[model samples]
Target: MDTIKKLLAAGKFDVVLNQLQERMLSDESEERKDALYYSAVALRYLGRLEEAHQRLDALLDCWSDFGRGHQELGHTMYALGREETALQAYYQALKLNPALYASWDATARIEAKLGNLQQAELNAEQAQFLQKQPKQVVGALNLFHEGKLFKAERICRAYLQRNPHHVEAMRTLALIGAKLDVLNDAEFLLESVLVLAPDYNRARYDYIKVLQRRQKFPQALAQAKLLRSDEPYNPLYKALHANLCSALDNHDEALSLYDELLSDKVGDVAGVYVAKGHLLKTLGDTKGAVACYQQAYQLQPLFGDAFWSLANLKTYRFDESEYQRMQAAVSANETRVEDKIHLNFALGKALEQQEAYDESFSYYRRGNVLKRETSQYKSEVLSQRVDAQVEYFDRDTVARWTHTSAQHRHLTPIFIVGLPRSGSTLVEQILAAHSQVDSTLELPNIPAIAHELNGRQVDRKKPLYPYILDELSAQQVEQLAQRYVDETRVYRSEAPFFTDKMPNNFRHIGLIKRLFPEAKIIDARRDPMDCCWSAYKQLFAEGQEFSYGFDTLADYYRDYLRMMKHWNQVFPGQIYTVFHERLVNDPELQITNLLNHLELEVEQQCFSPHQSDRSVKTASSEQVRQPINTKGIGQWRKFEAHLAPLKKALGDVLSEWAY
Candidate 1:
């Protein structure tokens, strides 16, 4: 850093550029980032703004989270007389590193020149405030924006130890925790910052995100309302408010807000169209949803999400021209990794619809490979989690640690859980067909509770959750149970029963039993190959990381089976298994047995669940909208020749499940 400053001061820009070029090529260390950054600075000083912009773009291609690169790019663009482009880059830089004083100053000047005095003053004030922060705090912010999260956390923690009241440091650390998926710790840190500085708008926005991730929808909605009131004209806050309303089942209001935002023709118009499409799809307005998704891609040709959403409908077909357009977009030089993933999946679906199986599989494999390259999932960690549950939740252990506390029986929650694409959604739709039941999307409350319990520490030791279940007091269990009920109330009506159909909740059965022993648990079972292959072929919006690879997905299915077997042994008859084949083969017998299990009278709606107007949000949404059929019963047979890896991974479990 001192050498770079001295070189700049000495007016040796060419020498600095040469040295940085060599370092960038030869050194793969952390210093490579500095080399890349300083090379751009040298290029800018040498009156080669285009070269500087190109180098910064390359830097960002390698590290998209590098805020400094964006800031430098902004400076280069400004020097090249592109004020609007520079402003966009500056906004992005501030989004990544709000403490970038120079970017703030630049933005203030640019906005003032554009005659936006209010925003200019706000940026100027931000610059002044950030200038007062310690250098260490600024360095930590830079590191955090560079995606060196662990190093940034260490620096932030060290700085906060000396200046604990630094709200920005707290916010940065909380954001790091969020990126690491330790949302509880992030929520705690942000909450503390807000308490100390109640008017901290940035911290409040982040707090809302943590709350949303934790499935505290009411709290998130409250925060969104506050932000909307503060800046009623801000499209970002209005979009968030609309999304929160949709999450809380206020579909009509969310649609209205989205329409209002769209009418203004504001930021990310294609994104607003996609959001409206999703809400319309959930409301069973298929034609309207299709039109919206089509409009989204038409407006932004590179927007792969719009294409993927259309394919995910499972009923949409692509013409040859549409396929060619997506292929071109996928191969485009400027297409981002995220967009490519979506395009590949969408193209795979399009090809599969045309019966081009090999080409379809290739696209699917490519998509999954790209997705896995960035995923943090490890099959071994999931294996250990399964093993922990088996070791900790045996019949004898449950009998000894069982909290004899009163289970919250005021509202019965029918839990439909199993592997992804294992007919859980279909089962939920059938059950929800009853007049006494309300269907909800995959509620995240149970998994959030499990995450909290698994992340709790004692004496700084590793978390012991299923094991910790043995030590919970009656009051604690009741409180946890009630919290689930209260958190889920937003998705409920006056119906006697509501379904929580989160397929991954199969892993948290023991926790469910501990909290709500009387709650009805339905294990929605399907043919292993069909279920695994189906999930492998689909791209989920989030979570279900195991589905991205074939062998890992099959092994995950095996683990799911092993865990389910253990749960059945530990608490026999508590869970009722519903086989997809049997249900489809004999609807009358299956529906009767299902109704008997729930202790409800059989309704005709259960037999014709497709006629119900309930919202379905799973990948099987389109499939469930039609009457039950055997079309998907043996889907694995179509890809049997290529499924040897999956079959081998499953081993004896395949024969045991009689697949």
Candidate 2:
């Protein structure tokens, strides 16, 4: 220690670090562990988190069973922002030696980072039980993790009461307080964390998250500004600030920052470029948007959303040969089923258009198999959850619907519904292009309403009509309906009729009919397998567990089918099924029929949905932004060998759909 300190005092930190590295490579002595740990401390002081992760990883791999080695690696991984892996490492460390109480703190941090409250609490207790020495922050983390905010606050308060400077403990208490809806307590504790840490990354992120939740935008912005200044090298800090700016509608600033960021790119951040591309796309800069999206895809080869955006843009339309490259890019080592499915679907459409039906169908089948496994079972579960919720509301709101029908008026909203990725977004863009229709993004209110009525474990088969109808007083129905209207009204500027193109709204078809009978429900359908496969091949921003794995997604899709069938049976002829295949082959004819149903007199240019200067924000945005093309008809071919599970799970659904 003195040797390094003397070297550091002599302004030779670099030399000190270098000697430690040499010792790491040459020394088989136990002295190497000490050398490595000190070297890591120096690297962290230098703010070289990546290098630190590498050094720590090297030490841990060499001394695999060592508790301190694992703890050091976990800390480094956390600093490097690999939260999930950090938690696992910490857990491994504690298992190797339960007396390593420091692992608890790291595990707590990782659990919170991943938003796993249950696990966080468990780790917090582990910290308490294993504490060889109790400090001012004793038990606060565990209390907060357990959602016992009051007790957490007391612990933190007591810490501050004695030490009056326990910054980290105060911050931990404040974070929980804010989430627990005790804003005043959060304000007090966070102020303390900030004052003590001054530049703590954890405290800063927690503060911003809390402020954003409170909708204190200006304060959040200020904190964001401070964070970027304090943590200039942290890309995540910059991204969060950019996101906040976007949310506040400071597009010019956001765009400028994004533009600057693009000028000096980083690794594996396809999401940022995609965001920038979507923004450019919104501003009618299709060429620039496509360029940005291509950059994103180039950076992260297996990023499904990037490919979806690129495919959505007129990339392949301008250059069909990109299909092979896109396919190759998608088939990389880290290929996700969702990306592959979408790629294959896009490829199939491209090939089929080029008279490659056999190959196209091959892609289609591979994707279908993947789609079947991931979405099927989950879909059924969701339907049951919604049904149970509806049953609760039905028991209460039944009489209101009957009494309210006579007094209702002006129900002209168009719901663009169907399976996700079934061209709902495209269809809505076309309809929204009409002079009378406002094309809003997906509406999650229907599901939100359903969830609030009843939690998960819903019963779909039981008739909720009588009970639910009785439950909703006309006032309540009107209030709930009006809530949807109010939330959506912001997105509608001057269009006479607005479209809420939530594809999953198909599940709530009955509710839609009851609430707004006059509203048009356009059901967008692609080839059954194709639609399922496309969805399966994605890793969405939201919690879509089934989509990531094969078996779960197929089951989810089948449930969607089952629920839609039940919806059809109970409310016959309610939703207008717009086949994606039909639209792709004969867009003009289909659009005209769809318009006629919406009671809009056909304008000659509805066929040119691509020409409309509107931005499509969904996964289909890149593709739909361009002119309608037939390149995604059957995209399941390249990996057909691996799709047996999907076929087995979804054979009946595929057979019924004539695939």
Per-model tally of clashing residue pairs: 0, 62
* Stretches of candidate 1 exceeding 4 Å from the true structure: 1-38, 48-67, 81-104, 107-132, 401-407, 456-462, 636-642
Please report the candidate that would top lDDT against the real structure: 1
lDDT of each: 0.85, 0.67
Model 2 residue 408 CA deviation (Å) reads 9.6
lDDT of 2: 0.67
Output the lDDT of residue 457, model 1: 44
Q: How close is candidate 1 to the true structure, as a TM-score?
A: 0.90
C-alpha RMSD of each candidate structure in angstroms = 3.2, 12.4
Model 1, residue 159: displacement in angstroms?
Answer: 1.9
lDDT of 1 by residue, 1-659 (tens): 68987998898999898777777875565577778888899899889988888888777776554677778889999999999999988887786677689999999999999999998998999999889878877787777765678898899899889889889888988988888788889999999998999888778888998898776888999998888888888888888888888877789899999999889988678898999999888878889999999999889887899999999999999998889889998886546567889999999999999988888888988999988977878887777888888888887876765455443476778999998888888898898889888777788888887888776442233457667776678788888988888778878888878899998999999898888877789999999888988999889988999999987897798889889999999999989999999988888899899999899889887999998887787788889999998788888787777788888888887788852
| Residue runs of model 2 more than 4 Å from their true location after superposition | 1-71, 74-241, 244-250, 260-274, 281-380, 386-400, 403-411, 455-470, 637-639
